[model samples]
Target: MTDLDYFDQFDDEGTEDSASKRDSLPDWVSNSNSSLAAYQAIQSLYKEKMQYIRGHSKKSHYTKKGSYHISKSEVARAAGLAKPNAIFHSVDYASKLTKELNDKNALLVASKEKILLSRSSSIKDLSKKELQSELRGRDRYKEISELKADEIVDLTLKRLPLDVKRQLYLA
Candidate 1:
């Protein structure tokens, strides 16, 4: 038979067929989508653990030599699962779980960035004294809080480091 016929044999079997036969997005993309959905569900169910994972996962890049893809092992680690251990024996199941956990980590990072943005915006609404207090820590805020409003305004109006002034809402 021709080369085309030989390749078509696998296509008929529905095993490692070409992209034209299956159509739609790649398997990795579909898998990542399911993984992301599963991770969101888990995050809602296990908020505390997910938070811990998010905090600890900052250093883990999961990139390969030529690609930026995160590895399944790294994902599983972030999910608090041990490799070659319980709850992930089957290859297919392990892969699915890894994708879910990795996607969840991505979501965690995104949410953190969003929270920071919202917090900065909210800070702008604070009064000068309140902003100064926030920037200088609670102890400093307590001292400033006891001062008269005019005194606080004077302190805020004084020339200060740009960052401190910005934090105090004077900039």
Candidate 2:
């Protein structure tokens, strides 16, 4: 049968409620199907409706439980940002967070490059005292690097949702 034949079959066997599409399928299919074809066959409707609601390209990839699958409307509703007559749009928080990430990325690159260049260059050429002094400098650099890494980690932890922070404390 042609593709249209299968389309007609789905339209006939379908339930009226919309959430039954394949994206919400149990994980067993993902491991067992071996075909990687659930989204096209079952979840396509949710993807299509979601795309139409949000203007996603018709051909965009939709992964199950993956990064692209995040639903802003659902998250917003859960966060209690949904209004009886409106949708919440919070830009400042995301913008500030993006700037922070960009800053961290740039700083980490600079730090890594500095450390690599300092360590990778030959140390054999230095006199004993100079070599010892350079070793001290390397120790200092390593300490600073650890501090910077800690700073990054602590900042990341600060951004964790409240429950995660509480669990971290209990652990």
Candidate 3:
């Protein structure tokens, strides 16, 4: 077959697959004549996009941006709607979904910030030796924590003056 014909065959197959997907949709979505179905589709698409943003799904077509929030246009395109404004046809439903999406995005940002803060605080608490070991790709924290009390006492005493060591042992 010619190159054009070959590509056209794939295009036709894609349409058929999409048609099958449409047929598989629930009755409320596939058979409805109302705009509610469109809103439902948009809501579901938004949720799917959020799943991609949250790294819960492997199939991601959306570009990675600094903001985690999904736009109305993105949802409309995912739902195969002609215009982004179509998502807002049902104002109440659209507003509710938008609020929920914003809340979820805020929570995700907050959680990430909390994780970064915890990591920074833990790093700051590390001793110079532990930090150097960590930079050398060694996990010193576990080894240090696992050190025996007697070993720690010996290590501490080894740094003291002879008189101090003698006095400490006498006491």
TM-scores of the candidates in the order shown: 0.28, 0.20, 0.35
- Residue runs of model 2 more than 4 Å from their true location after superposition: 1-91, 120-171
lDDT at 8 for candidate 3?
72
lDDT of each: 0.52, 0.44, 0.57
Report how far off residue 94 is in candidate 1 (Å). 0.2
| Clashing residue pairs in candidate 1 (N, C-alpha, C atoms within 3 angstroms) | none
Candidate 2 residue lDDT tens string, 90-168:
3323433233334443543444344434543356534577789988999987875778777878767877899987887
Clashes of each: 0, 2, 0
For candidate 1, the per-residue lDDT at 46 reads: 43
Query: Which candidate's TM-score is highest?
Result: 3
Candidate 3 collision pairs:
none
Model 2: which ten-residue window has the lowest total lDDT?
33-42
Candidate number achieving the greatest lDDT relative to the actual structure: 3
In angstroms, give how far residue 109 of model 1 lies from its true place. 1.3
Cα RMSD for candidates in order: 16.3, 24.1, 11.1
Residues 1-107, candidate 1: write the lDDT tens digits: 99988887574454646565436432543333334333434545346534544443222322221122334444445545565343244544546655555665576
Clash pairs for candidate 2: 22-42, 22-43
TM-score of predicted structure 2: 0.20
